[model samples]
Target: MSVTAPSLPAELAARRGSTVELRGLVRDFGGGVGLTGLDLAAGPGEFIALLGPSGCGKTTALRALAGLERVDGGSILVDGRDVTGEPASRRDLGMVFQSYSLFPHLDSAQNVEFGLRMRKVPAAERRRRAAEALELVGLGGHGARYAHQLSGGQQQRVALARALVTEPRVLLLDEPLSALDAKVRVQLRDEIRRIQTELGITTFFVTHDQEEALAVADRVAVMRAGAIEQIGSPEELYHRPATAFVAEFVGLTNRVPGMVAGGVLSLLGAPVPLAAPSADGPVTAYVRPEDVLLAAEGVPATVLTTSFLGAVRRTRVRLEDGTELAVQHGTREHPAPGERVGVALAPTPVTVAPAV
Candidate 1:
């Protein structure tokens, strides 16, 4: 016989999610501002990440969507309905914070049932829902454990169960994996993505971790100075970034001085044809470490350093002209720091910006 999965509660399944739209949202903080007419949208069941450095307004934008922070102008909409003025309690959103906000006195099941209790759910139904939520998070047998008795990862799992048990219209994650260790963060992040996919709820996740954001989100919005600098799929953002900020922020890049003329850039004595329009003058070409190749008959250079990264090794080399660049290679035969070598471009397209 084929095994079948359990079904979600009918009432809960009926309220899966809705499209979220932020129209020129603005939040001011006197001296400068929190958000400067920021606009974003997420389709039903789509996972979107707001990624940026500290104080770039990513968290502020998430808070505004959750109705925790007031917006000074513009509107918030869900499924094409205006909810700009709705209070936090009426917004029907489930939020998970970086800190596991579980009550010390409450066990896992009790914590998961707290929201239902506040909504006046009957005791029997609340118990059933709480049990289901715990099972959903792979913590079904640990419901009797309190926060203090559970590990950090388990506590965060309980917190997630509590937020998800409500079956709210939207799911908001505010750097939920920031507090855990590297391994636990990766494991829990994968779990979160799995659960979100099973439920098909529209999700808005905020984080400063590029790897985490790129791994978990369907699309990433890079923010800067209280505004969105660029938004695109992870591959698009990494490969064809619109600006130098997006190119440098989304991944590691090496800025090399080059000159452009007749739609070709001359870098390190090589001619690279430009795919996009660039000013005919000096420019800073951004090249990824992996795009730099170590060849036997290329620009002569001396190895500076080599760092092992599992399947690949990142080797830094200094050219005859004293220019340094990093090259990633899969071979384990690494040269000494003073050993001579040759480096060349990998024939991949590069991004160029005005020289600074």
Candidate 2:
């Protein structure tokens, strides 16, 4: 989707992108751990997403970078300057939380001007900047509308405008789209990516939704146990996961029993190449649903169920030995439950974990 917003002012347009680095970050919540020696770095104008399941420290890392959370150990550096001891207001960062957090009494323009007002900017300049920011977020004529008067999506646009009005060195988004419905969430996320690209600002987005991270990030960092398990481009993470955890987390994966010998996995009745070296033994292969196809001649199976997903259809089939596998195919080919069919495994390289 294409998103068109008004051009930023000359001063805001000339804002140079900043580099950010998190070195050995550690945050302990007494008995609970938030971060454990986490390390990450972002280049100027880079968009990185921190993604993982609950309790993975993605939020903690973003909060620590924004100076909203104190670190037990480690340092935060922006543009070669250490800011570990700086306060949230002094960190020169902009953050948008999951909650709108807009003042009910303030209109859109005033809400967008809150940061500038706190910075002691003159009234005239603040007004001009606030108006420009509202225009930039596609709320140009709605500046007079209060939070209650605007829709949930519009309120979020206002919140986003508020965050960008100050022109901070880095932008931090903590589940900013979580509160919106599916359609609005998709639209707003695309708009956010477009705005971030136009501004050329460093951004860190925290989200537990894998699809969201994959759709709009230059690189995705998958966290586990308060530390990053893997960091790579969306395509790399999906096609060539470095670990079993990442293989299962980033996309839909089917665990098929297999035997490995000479770096090749014997899955079903087909021999598939291994993505990485594994000891020769019984193992569970991580396979993508698309890799399993319905064929006219292969291992015998019975269709258990099928789900129609937007452009493609995913069908679950049970093998003669009782192992269930999900196969993805075009919607034109629909197989009913209890229908006997032949299934085949494509010779794709797969990641595998030791058998339980």
- The lDDT for every candidate, in the order shown, is 0.88, 0.93
Measured against the true structure, the TM-scores of the candidates, in listed sequence, are 0.95, 0.97
Write model 1 residue lDDT over 1-356, tens digit each, in one string.
11124455565556555899999999999966599999999999999999999999999999999999999999999889888899988988999999999999999999999999999999998999999988877787888999999989889989999999888889999999999999889988888888888788999999999999999899999999888999999998898888999888988888878899987898888986654679889998888888888889889999999988989999999998888898888866687899999988876677899888
Error of 1 at 259 (Å): 1.7
Candidate achieving the largest lDDT: 2
Residue runs of model 1 more than 4 Å from their true location after superposition:
1-16, 273-275
Writing each residue's lDDT as its tens digit, candidate 2 over 1-356 gives 23566776677777778999999999999878699999999999999999999999999999999999999999999999999999998889999999999999999999999999999999999999899888888888889999999989899999999999999999999999999999989999988998898889999999999999999999999999899999999998998898999999999999899999887789996789898899999999999999999999989999999999989999999998889999999999999999999999888889999999
User: Where does candidate 2 have its weakest 10-residue lDDT segment?
Assistant: 1-10
187 Cα displacement, candidate 2 (Å) = 0.2
lDDT of 1: 0.88
